[model samples]
Target: MDGLPTRESSPGVVVLPGNRAELVAIVRALAASGVPFVARGAGTGLSGGALADSDSVLITLTRLTRILSIDPIRRRAVLEPGVVNARLSEAVLPYGLAYVPDPSSQTACTIGGNVAENAGGPHCLKYGVTTNHVVALEVILPEGEIVRLGSHAGEPW
Candidate 1:
């Protein structure tokens, strides 16, 4: 919340709520606040995707980390943006389950960031980028509409 960088060339910071309902509230406030904001994960983004402007608010999603559920029968996982990529595999290993999309930053990068960038790793040559594995995304549109994008059909959003 505080002690966050807010330089003109850097990004600003704003505290966010911890749960989905609170996230919705923040999104609504952001839409109406007339302030520019960018969502961030582990700050592992190499592209300009996670970068922010001086007037922008950096909505770090690190606090949203969680592995809600993993369905081995369905070979699917319901996860929060803050979940670490490799952690998913480790968490679901006993179930004979594994996440297909694994990036180089799998140990530290949040799954949410991987989704945002469609990240790829060495294994990507065989498995493909993050976009190839994602099913559905519960997203907040620009107008603060929390909508479900994509489907459980393993399509890109």
Candidate 2:
């Protein structure tokens, strides 16, 4: 999500994909048709980047909130973009782990939005920002290609 804020604006289309495959297909079709679109995760962005304009398609990712995997030993979790920040920490609490970047909006903001904003809060001074903790990503490109990048191992950032 990266664009101007639109309050009270009506979008031409609003899509909520239930799964990754459906999301990919929608993006592919939109790209091929040359339709302008914006993707959003949880719609809790303070930057107003998630708001959609009248002519563009708004792809809301709220339905994609699944924490796919959690490796407590590695301190890494694979989650859909819409999973709330605090939820991740809560999920890992039983494992004696916590997601450290405690943004003020953590209770409402999603991990994807935090990644987009490189979000940090009071813990940043001691723990660093989101990038420092994120090891890898499975990204869907603007043209609808799914590509996995980076090593899910040791790293400074």
Candidate 3:
């Protein structure tokens, strides 16, 4: 929701990519055509950040949900953008670990939106927000270029 600009008008097109490759291709085509687009996770945001203009393209990340890996020993997890906030903690609970950023909307909010908004909840009073727990991010730039930000190895540098 952090990227969209308008709420009243529906986007001209809405795409839900099942994987990263499809997402990249869609982005590339949109860029080539000079079409404005917005990436959306869940529609659970309180702010109108997920709104789009009538001429814009909305790329919903819901189908991209996947927990790539969970390293309990390292206390880290690799996940796709559409992975739900609470679900991550539940998945790792069996490993005797948990993702700490528990926003009130965790039940329905996606991890991507939590990262976008730096969301936090009652637990944040002691644990901190999404950014503090997220170790890495695989992002697609506006020009359709994919890049990795942060290190999966958990090294800040």
Candidate 4:
């Protein structure tokens, strides 16, 4: 892992937000303080997408692991960024539902990372990648403003 081509400099600070409010606050404070920051998930991505250089702060989403809501009838689920990719499927298995993005690192990768990388795996040949399964996204802008992209109704905004 350390020898991966995508590996970069180490981060100076690391923070894990327990919830949405805390995540927002941290982003706000970091922005106001003029410190660079990068959002990171399971850190299992082969592309080094989660790497943060020394000048940046690493905001790990591990603590935000929660399946916020699920609508079996709609086949939609709202989850925190830290939720593991495989866990989502496990959670909805009883409802005969599953998230379709099956990244190779599914067991350890987080939904946020899957979204960031638009990850794909063996099943992608039939199911498509993360972007195909993602119906919406609730994201915090660099300035600390939060906004929703796309909608639960499966419409992109």
Candidate 5:
């Protein structure tokens, strides 16, 4: 059971820890192997962003799904990249706080993918796109460096 399911050189997915420690390990492995890979969310992507290529690693972030913090007073929720879009909003709904952007695939789409694709949904017609609600981002770059992209009080881009 510890072995891979297929004997052939088939596409594979690795589930790593979703914490900071695990993130470091994942990055280290990718860096050491010098392999080109793609970071994927719920696999609800329509742009083929999650498709595996030759010798390409698909780093699944689904296990990282967690709502780290929610600010009812500020109407903001800080979440892991793997957190589903609709779930985040649902978590805050009781407090009258909601994530404005709602992609068609919000139920399955992840925050990471939405941010990467910069998606917009029907609700965006009045509220705006993903970037509008996102205040900040903690991204693990290709080189395995963790970087904070923006601030909560400032522009997202």
Candidate 6:
């Protein structure tokens, strides 16, 4: 089950990766074994993306909540996928900055899920969505190859 009450799913395995290294290893093993897997960040969406079938594995990002760095000058942050949206805003408040998407579930939703789906809230009309704020992405491919998309200064596409 994810955020929606009517929705339900059962994964073959549930793994909470403690760090990027563990995550890469898990992904590699799963890929090598030909097991399907889905990455979940906070499991806070009604979209059911976090839900995985019994034949697939659910890789939860909850334990990866570290906010790696905050650059007040660029109003940017280097964060782990599980960093809560509201927490980001709170963390940057002293710098007179904010994570503006602020979806209704900001308190529970995460940067990874937001970035994955380009999330937005009512303020999107004025501030635009998550994509407007994301300058780059560091992703792990299905085969466990790590790649950085986009440039530090702007979006890739």
Q: Let me know the TM-score candidate 4 reaches against the reference structure.
A: 0.93
Worst lDDT 10-window in candidate 6: 148-157
What is the per-residue lDDT of model 5 for residues 119-144, given as tens digits with 9 covering 90 to 100? 78888999888878777888788878
Q: Write the per-residue lDDT of candidate 6 for residues 72-146, one digit (tens) a residue.
A: 997779999989999999999999988899789999999998887688998899999999988888999999999
List runs of model 1 lying over 4 Å from the truth.
Answer: 1-8, 153-157
Best-matching candidate per TM-score? 6
TM-score of candidate 2 on Cα atoms, chains taken together: 0.89
TM-score of each: 0.87, 0.89, 0.92, 0.93, 0.85, 0.95
Candidate 1: lDDT over CA atoms?
0.78
Q: How far does residue 89 in candidate 4 sit from its true spot (Å)? A: 0.8
lDDT winner, 2 or 5: 2
On lDDT, the leading prediction is 6
Task: Write the residue-wise lDDT of candidate 2 on 30-124 in tens digits.
Answer: 99999988888766666777777888999988788999999998888999988999999999999999899988888988898888778888999
Model 3 lDDT, residue 49, Cα: 69
What does the lDDT come to for candidate 5?
Answer: 0.75
Better model by TM-score, 5 or 6?
Answer: 6
Between candidates 3 and 6, which one is better according to lDDT?
6
Q: Write the per-residue lDDT of candidate 4 for residues 90-131, one digit (tens) a residue.
A: 999999887878877788889998899898888889989888
Task: List the candidate 5 regions with Cα displacement exceeding 4 Å.
Answer: 1-13, 155-157
lDDT by candidate, in order shown: 0.78, 0.85, 0.85, 0.86, 0.75, 0.89
C-alpha displacement of 4 in model 2, angstroms? 8.8
In candidate 5, what residue range of length 10 has the lowest lDDT sum? 1-10
Q: Write one digit per residue (lDDT tens) for candidate 3, span 46-122.
A: 66667667789999998988999888889988889899999998999999898888877788889988887788888
